[model samples]
Target chain A: MDSTCRRMRAEILDISFSSGHGHIPTCFSVVECLYAAYEVMRHDPKRPDWAERDRFVLSKGHAALGYYAVLAQHSYFDIKEVAGFGAYNSRFGCHADRTKLPGVEASTGSLGHGIGIAVGMALGERVAGRQTKVFTLIGDGESNEGSVWEAVMVANNVGLNNLTIIYDHNKSQGRCLPVTNPGERFRSFGCEVVEVNGHNVDALKEVFARPATGVRAVIADTVKGYGCKTLVDNVNEWHRKSPDAEQLAKLLEELHAPAI
Target chain B: MRRQFKETTTALAATDPRVAVVLGDVSVYMFMDFHRANPGKFYNMGICENSLISVAAGMTATGMRPFVHTIAPFLTERSLEQIKLDCAYNQWPVNIVTCGASFDYAWDGATHHCYTDLAILRLLPNMEVLQPGSRREVDALMRATYDSGKPTYIRLSDHPHDVETNLEFGKGTVLREGKSGVTVMTAGPILPNVMAACEDLDVNLVYFHTLKPMDRALVERFRHDRILVVHDAFGLQEAINEVPGLRTWYHGLPDQFCAWYGTVHDIRARIGLDAPGIRKAVTTLLETPSA
Candidate 1:
């Protein structure tokens, strides 16, 4: 693994322990993907707020610590702010508050809402004659909301070529994975569905490179706990388990090591 | 009254490129002028109320000022989540204009009557609810809403009526001024009933055109003594509850599905909201002083 990716993983593991919960692991895996993407686009010489820059929204805002850590890696904000996660008057919290955080487009915490907000932003950008692209990451469980489908239909109906919706298909939300396949369901809504290994940084990079002409849904098949060997494949209990001293040491060691 | 809204929205859309009017498959009778003038901006988003509001929210986020027109029930209740999250939560300046307030669709059945819209909307943060009593007031409110730059819900009546007094945003208009015995606060099409009930009585008639802000000064002054609230819908009770130190007697229906029946007059009389019912409630309250 590169130094930047390793550093972000370590920061995510540290912040995940702040809440003393295990949900940080899933957040860490996604952040690793985001950090890798940001690194590739660092010296592209494009405007920071360029109309064509790829946009990302964390639909599952409860895992915002992971997002903030990745943003810090990209120098979107000071890295020191990560320590203030969930602290008094901290912008970084369990859920993303758009009002407080820069580059955080929509204020999302209510499930099944982030995708709709992103669709609006994408449509807005398109209507404004901007060629910018929009990407929103939602939890598989959030698909339970009917508004998600409402957004899916709108995105496809309007031919939102600039929008890409990613599903963090961890297969475990609170207790178990939903019985239905989210990717196929998104396809039914007229989205170009892409199923990829969420942990594979290369795969995510490839998916991000292509903006769908008609809404796209990338089903990122990620494990609930991805990094630490013991917790990597564990689905049910690891959704949110705070790391103990021993577990923390193992996670830190694994993060410092090379890519598996 | 409906044509007035269509004309105002159509005129505004002509000059303003950012103005888009979205309807829920029911603009045929209301928005012919707007469609003729600005074909690209006018969209009938089918019968999907949820999608209509969501699309309007999206349009608002992008810099377009969208006016969404539909029936009161579907606009307020059916797609309530979209209204709360997409518009109120985001604080998008989308004008939600409902054409038939309070039994305008009386014959359409119980599902179309939107008596609970005001009550439900008042609970949302940063949403301004307006119930215009007259055609003039409706036009003035619509014009102001286009420039107000706030998330607003303008509840319009089906029939036309005369504006006894000029109505303003966030301020209740005094239709009949009487001594401080008992004040009757009402809104929308029920204003005529309230006016009739206040004639030759020692009761003040305050018409609450705006529902959300609730005119704190007006409420405080009226709250000094006894007050009787005669709302066309059930949700006005929640608004009255915010005022302190007042004996409030609610004159609306109970919090349940309204039974489908005849006109607004028939439903009002059946549910004890007519001039006679309001007169008796006011007279009874004024005759007896609080302990």
Candidate 2:
């Protein structure tokens, strides 16, 4: 896993493992990509509604733990907010709620909505004569939704060079679901596909740095639980299962404290 | 009706810069002039209703007042979720204008029929539903909804209109005012049918182009009298339910898929929504004593 994003993952683990109701594995899978994307995004924490601020929506919304952690790490809220993960009046919902949270651009637990919304945001910038860029992250499983392809075709037809889509390709069909080929499919939709190691923060940063052109997509290849040994070995099997107290200790030991 | 919508959309763009249009490639020619007039504001978003709605919401978030148009079934049923979550849940003001009301494309078969648009959109808590019966009402309601700053659903029907009346949110205009304790109320192009039905009777006739904030005050007028709701849909039932005690007889398409295909008039006859059928239903309600 990218060391720069490891701390964010640790925060995510604590929130989800403690809440006992979160997508820990899915959140872990996209940490490196989100960390890299959030860093290079032209956004201001104080001015969350800044008209020209770069917009990011997690279409793979189950990975809200990681998204919330990243926002907290960016100082959108205090780190202490993570402790109240799924609390009754928490700004952070189980899925990202733009209404509740400051940094969240859209509420997106429903699999395949983010891309189209992002496309509209890109078009909004065009209409207003602003150079703001819109970015979204989707899952390998989410591409199965026809709305994703619908937006893909619209984005292609509209020539939205200011939009960027990052697919966290964890191959998460879970045996029953077919592992769809997002890279080739995206290419067919006329997106400029660039594959990167999602675990490598530097590589993700470099891929994102290449200025948005022609509705580009970054197929970040990574595993569902990259660094956590118990979760990493078995892909997505321990996804929804929150760790027990004993398991949480071992997870913290491996993720938080390096072997001195 | 489509031509009027296109003209109104162009006129709206001329006055309001925030007005933008996105269609599902269904009405290409209808928007050509608007596209030429407002370069980046009008977009033919292809035949993707889900994307069209979400994209409209996205544009709304960035301070753009976006109006989406497509077939009734495709726009309402296909993208209902997006309309609920993306537009209504977020309180983003999106103007959803749908053509092919009920079965405007009767020969196109069951796939094109949309009898439950009122029910479908009414069930969603956030949408304000409007159905324009005449050319004047269409222009008035469209302009009002665009400037209303709330998510709205407008149905454009091929039904002709002779009455010229103003529109207000949650209010109905009294077309043929009467105080015989029996009022015939309806919305959309069907208004003409109800008028034809009650043409010989000494009864009240009201038209509610807007359904959501239904003119509850109008219900007060018919508090003790019987009501003949012509296309009585969506908020009418609930509004009537609230009038303490009153008699209501509703006539519209039934709650089943239109089993056969024919002209819109034939389909209306089959479903008992034609002028004669409506008149008969109103006569029956008029005979019933208010208990």
Candidate 3:
């Protein structure tokens, strides 16, 4: 894992521990994906509502902590401000609200919605004759929704070469309704499917920067809890769990340790 | 009304570069001219109703005023979450104009019937619900609220009444005044049946096209009277009841699915929404002692 993503994993853990809110495993799954997207996206953190900037929607909205941490890294806001996650009067909620937050394009908590919105944004770009690209990240579990496939089909059929759908294939739904062979599924839906190591920020940045024909789908094969062994091994139990003081220490220790 | 939708929207699109249409493959033929003229702005984007709404919301985010059209039940009911989350909650100005209101698709069976759209959609925060009952009303309301920067729902029915209305978006019309303390309030295309039913009857008549910000001041005017909300759908009575202490009774659909397959008139006649049947309901309400 890159040093920035590892530090973000630590921030996600600290915030989740302090707030006692978040789907930590899910957040861990998409940190690098979110970081990579922002790295390539033409956006100004100061001017999130910049008219001509590229757009990103977190379709798998449960991973908002990860998104927030990554956005904080990008200077959208300070990392310390995210301590109020899921608290009253906090801009950062368990799920993102676009009206409340600066960088959030669409308020998405319900699965399978952001991708469709992203497709529409791409279409809007096409209609306006602008080259503004739109990107969205969807969970493997969220892919179970028929609306996900519905959007995938629409994006391709509309010939949205400006839209890129990043599938967080963390095997989160391996216990039930797994989206087996997501690359094949996206290809079948007429996307330019790119399979990659999700935790590798460089690899993700490469795919995001590369040109495409029609809607692009990046199948980021990822571990549910990437950097920490305890969380990685027991992903199902830690899926929506927040870490305690002692557990937070262990997780941080695991995060900073060299990869085995 | 659909023809008026094409005309009004085509005229709007001629000047307003931001005006676009996203169809769920329901009225592609009707919008052929629109598709030809504004090819980039029009999309007959397959039968996916959910995507139609979400996509329009996306378009709205980009400063485009999108009119998302489809059959009522599929567009409103099936893609309801998309409407609630993407358009309403996100506060996108998506104009959802749907056809096949209530039993307009009567021969297509209960699957095509959509009576819950207005009632359910009005509950969403910052949503505008309009049921235009004539070509004039459709043209008027669409022109007024199409780019109003609010998520608006304009339901167009094939069977529109010819009665000239207030043409205002949220205000109700006082079509008749009577000495009796009974008011027959109805909305949408069923106003003609309601008009014909109450024409000879000694009762006050009221009508509405906007159900969300329902003319509460007008409904309050009849608060002392027995307001019998006569309509073919569930929303008008609920809107009237929003004004407190008014004795309002719904003379609309029952709890059962309208299972029979036939024409809209046949279904309306059977369900006591036709001229004579509505007259009978009004007379029954008037004759019964106030409780």
| lDDT per residue (tens digit) for residues B112-187 in model 1 | 8887788888788888888887778887887777656668888888765675655677787777777857888877
Worst 10 residues of 1 chain B by lDDT: B159-168
| Candidate 2 docking DockQ | 0.77
TM-score of 1: 0.90
For all predictions in the order shown, the interface RMSD in Å is 2.2, 0.7, 0.6
Better of 2 and 3 by lDDT: 3
Best candidate (score: lDDT):
3
Task: Give, for candidate 2 chain A, the lowest lDDT window spanning 10 residues.
Answer: A251-260
lDDT (10s digit) by residue, model 1, range A133-237: 777888767777777787788778767898878788777654554637777788888989999888777778788776466888888887665666556655445
lDDT of 3 at A181: 94
| Model 3: CA > 4 A from native | none
Q: For each candidate, what's the DockQ? A: 0.42, 0.77, 0.88
Off by over 4 Å in 2: A235-237, A256-260, B177-180, B232-246
Q: Using lDDT as the measure, name the better of candidate 1 and candidate 3.
A: 3
Chain A only TM-scores, each candidate in turn: 0.86, 0.94, 0.98
**Candidate 1 wrong stretches, greater than 4 Å:** A1-3, A36-54, A173-179, A257-259, B46-48, B147-149, B289-291
* Superior candidate under lDDT, 1 versus 2: 2
Tell me the TM-score for chain B of model 3: 0.98
